[model samples]
Target: MQNLGKADKTTDEIFEDHLLNFNTQQVNATRLHKDINNYLRCIRAMQTANKNLMDTLSEIYEKEWVGQDMLYVQAQNNEMLWADLAHKLADQVVTPLNTYQAQFPEMRKKIDKRGRKLIDFDAERHTVQQMQNNPNRNEAKFIRAKEQMENAKRTYEVLNSELHDELPALYDSRILFLVTNMQTLFAAEEVFHSETSKVYSELEAVVDKLAKEVQKGTLPRRAYNRPLPIANHSAPVIQNSSSMNSPPKGATTDNLPPGVLYKVKAAYKYQAEDVDELNFEVGEIIQVVEYEDPEEQQEEGWLMGVKESTGQKGLFPANFSRPI
Candidate 1:
């Protein structure tokens, strides 16, 4: 009876309480596998898009441009780094999730088999109850029913015990998988970003060289997408009326005095009124230097500036210059 597909069909209520964890795990695992596949697909798609963009750049970059050869090399390196990162994600994350999902189908089959055994166990119990209440009970029939019920009980209990132990452990295994996958994914991205950071820095240096060449007349000037880099700047210096009387000696553009804050472009020409004042033609860049007596106040709208070309430090109307 157990080997054959035969069990008594009766109106009986079968209560199964151990299936909650298994059901929840199945749902979560299925969704997780789907999401991992989608994530890998998106990564590959992004890599493809980036490769296409790099190829376009390599085609249009002319030999006349400074650092043209290096641009091609770094572009290739960028694509290679993207490919390497995608490969690692597929191997480290997607592969493990796929392996994890593989366990579910086999376990599902066993669960279905357990349900069938439970039906048999319940049917045998019902038959034995019927035999016990019969007014003209048959001894042999009662004995057979009792034996069948005992066999069904033992079989169902064995399977139920196994599943009871396995479900909680399987659920807990997800924690280890989660930790391992996240660590691997993050570690791969860290390496990819670290390597690409160096590539990006080198690319910036190449562009800086190109920009310098264009400005110095070594290469033809072309309109660029980015602005030229500027030197670091701090706040303009404050000086007392007494310190503004003379130039800082031996200061030049080549050897700027210490505490030079920033460069300012002279927008208009102003002639000197006194020995302490500055004279400049339009478009001269002046270095705004800090004074030793930063605590004292000078008259507002009159700032002391140093001419980089001549190292002449004197008072210039603050309104006449603009920060570069």
Candidate 2:
């Protein structure tokens, strides 16, 4: 009887020890599972961060490529417009030169008539000088010669006035018209060249940017308009350590929550007092927020306390409200 009691007591003690050890092991296992889950959550967060970075990079690259392509197209259109201006300027120069050449002969005839009148005046002056120097000159002949000289002098003065005044005015007017036309045509030509040069410069910069992007691996190694496939699109998720280490099969994008999408655009240098190479512009959308500021009424004392805590002078009642 004593031996049986001792054996029964020994068995009970062994069973209690076994139960304690099992419970200890269960607690250890739960702790280990919690640690593994925490580790997995950290890993998933890191992986998600990496994926987000990659997507952002891809989007930036695409925007740059598309914007550069559009610039190239616009440059081409400007080139066409410049060519048209060149043609129009050429026409303008040619038509005016043709008109002036056609009118040249009539202008020459008027100049010749004035030249003959000047010659007659010189001859009449010589006759007057000869009569004045002679002592035995006939009075009637001298008087008639004097009258003829006066008439010739008067004719010469009239011709001189017409040539110096009216004729020159007409000639000057024609010359000014030609000069103004030429100046206008030249200005148009200059504008054409200048516009073309500006377009070429702008296009060259865009092309250079595209080239560097390609070389630096920001853009794909293909033509600008060509389609390319994205690589490595796997998502990250927290996992339980009790399961196998391998990822589940047949995972799709539907498992992820919806995210905002944006198109990529060109990168360029921004100028203030200094130049900054910014990949995005002011009007570009960067992020979306869930809520916006709202105003509300509150007791003056409560507002003062809230302001003191937040270090602000103004406080809105809505700030303390919970989001639904």
Candidate 3:
């Protein structure tokens, strides 16, 4: 029998192209990674070997002895430091020692013959420092400061006494005088205002009285007849018996003709310039004009021949004589 599965070359061809390309890319990438990793490992191994070799060389160099010139320079520097310290300390010690030598020769000789005494050095240095610094052991400065403070205190006390004791009394006296003057002025102003008000009230009352007096009519009718100096003051005597009996019984002024004629009571005011002309007196008959409005009931009247003054005029109700 022949092989039944013959290869499909066309399909296989396309698939093989793709697979070959993919395999080529994967192989190239893997080869590049391996080369890089091998290069890194080699470089690290070289670095480790170089570091170990350097460390071994350094250890060997350290163990092998060099010459002493380097150490000699360091020793010379240490010697210089020691000499500087000795010079500085020698000056501080020499002064104290010399001070002891000059001031206390016995002590100085004993210290020098034996060794330098610590106590003598300390005492002399302390004494020299104290003598050099004058403010520390100064009695005169304390005395001067105390005197200055005392003078300042005395001045302050004197000024305070003048300000607090004497000046306050003067200020209080001036304030009291001002207050008393203000009170007196205020009282005088009040009194003046009250007196002025009282005078004004009295003048107003007098003027009102004069105006009321001038309102009464006393002029003659023709202006030619001599008016009596004053009107009659007596009450009228009624000759008719009908007028003497007080009307029939409940007859009011409204029911009567010539309603409620009554004589003027007294001379209230007249056409008088300073009371020299006619003055309305008690007996002048007045005609009462009855009120038309029943609610008011206020009586109105007209006087006969009672002339007004020169600058004044007589007044009357407009409906004085009309029929009720």
Candidate 4:
């Protein structure tokens, strides 16, 4: 029988044309596979980058800073979330896509084998037809040729039917698979963002509180000297005194300098003629000043300043006076 609109073309040529069209569909499916693979690769890269970023944030988080513990916890959770996402993508999306693409090569092989079988079956039929017109035709040879044709036809039909059922189903599954993958990705991202936002807000609150405390002077200023404890006195004293009764010789208000923080009343009477010590009576005020030589101030529980009453500059026990 002649194929419509191609009377000159043989059955084999028509079959080849059909195979070419099927191959075109296969190419489209292959392209779809590549696209899906590319998408999966990008997702994996993003997951790695996200995990690295979270790790970096965790590393930089100061241990003593407010919300630092919470930041560490959040970073761990984010890493786990990313791992879970990658796992799900691999199991539910990437693996299935790979499996689907893997089938194409085997299916193409079967299609090629079926075409070969069709050609063999046609050749056997033609041989039988030609032999039937021979004056000395052998019945056994004809039967053998007919049996071979039947076997070839049955084999080709089975492969054809299997491919016909499988190919269409595989192609149709692309839509469902793509939708499921996208839904999973978006859902995971939503969860990640929601959790991270809480962490971010908490950190912001901590920063605000710290800022307010600094502004109010409740937080200790950076780089300011901390009072040292003295071995002689029980405790350091803080007091406020405006002026001294009588300034001592060589110790004038001008000699005290602008660096003097304030004056403190002596908590205890100290009598020492040592060049390094300051002689002072109880109730006398001493001007506290920044040390000209920082090495001299390193002595524990001692400050270098001038006695406001006598204007004598020397070292004295910090715990013996109350800051004014």
On TM-score, the candidate that comes out on top is: 1
The global Cα lDDT (0 to 1) of model 3 is 0.36
Better of 1 and 4 by lDDT: 1
Error of 2 at 291 (Å): 58
Q: Residue 299 deviation, candidate 4, in Å?
A: 10
Query: What TM-score number comes out for model 2?
Result: 0.32
lDDT (Cα, 0-100) at 67 in candidate 4: 61
Can you write out model 2's per-residue Cα lDDT over 1-324, one digit (the tens) per residue?
Answer: 224452121123433453354345435434544553464455446445644653454445454373555564544556465456545544665455445444444544654665566556556666666788899888788888888878877876675555455433444455576576658666876776687677667657776887887788777433222111221223222121222222223323233223311111112221222121112322232211111211111121111111112222222211121111
For residue 82, model 1's alpha carbon misses the true position, in angstroms, by: 1.2
Error of 1 at 291 (Å): 55
Cα RMSD (angstroms) for every candidate in the order listed: 15.7, 48.5, 57.9, 11.3
How would you encode candidate 4's per-residue C-alpha lDDT over 1-324 as one tens digit per residue? 223442232244544555665666567667867886787688788879977887887787555555667767766776776677667766766677667667678867877787777666666666776787887989898889888878877876776667666656655665786677668767866776787677567657767876786678676323434344343446454321223223322334544457775566787877764676788888898887766655454455566668866788886766787655
lDDT values for all models:
0.74, 0.43, 0.36, 0.66
Q: Tens-digit lDDT track for model 1 on 119-232? A: 888888978987898979999989999999999989987877787777667778988998998899899989989998998898788889978987887885443222112222
Q: Which residue pairs show backbone clashes in model 4?
A: 239-323, 239-324, 240-324
Q: Mark the regions of model 3 whose C-alpha exceeds 4 Å error after superposition.
A: 1-137, 167-179, 210-324
lDDT computed for candidate 4: 0.66
Candidate 3 minimal-lDDT segment of 10 residues = 315-324
Q: Which candidate's lDDT is highest?
A: 1
In model 4, the runs with Cα more than 4 Å from the true position are 1-48, 133-140, 203-324
Question: On TM-score, who's better, 1 or 3?
Answer: 1
Return model 1's CA RMSD, one decimal: 15.7
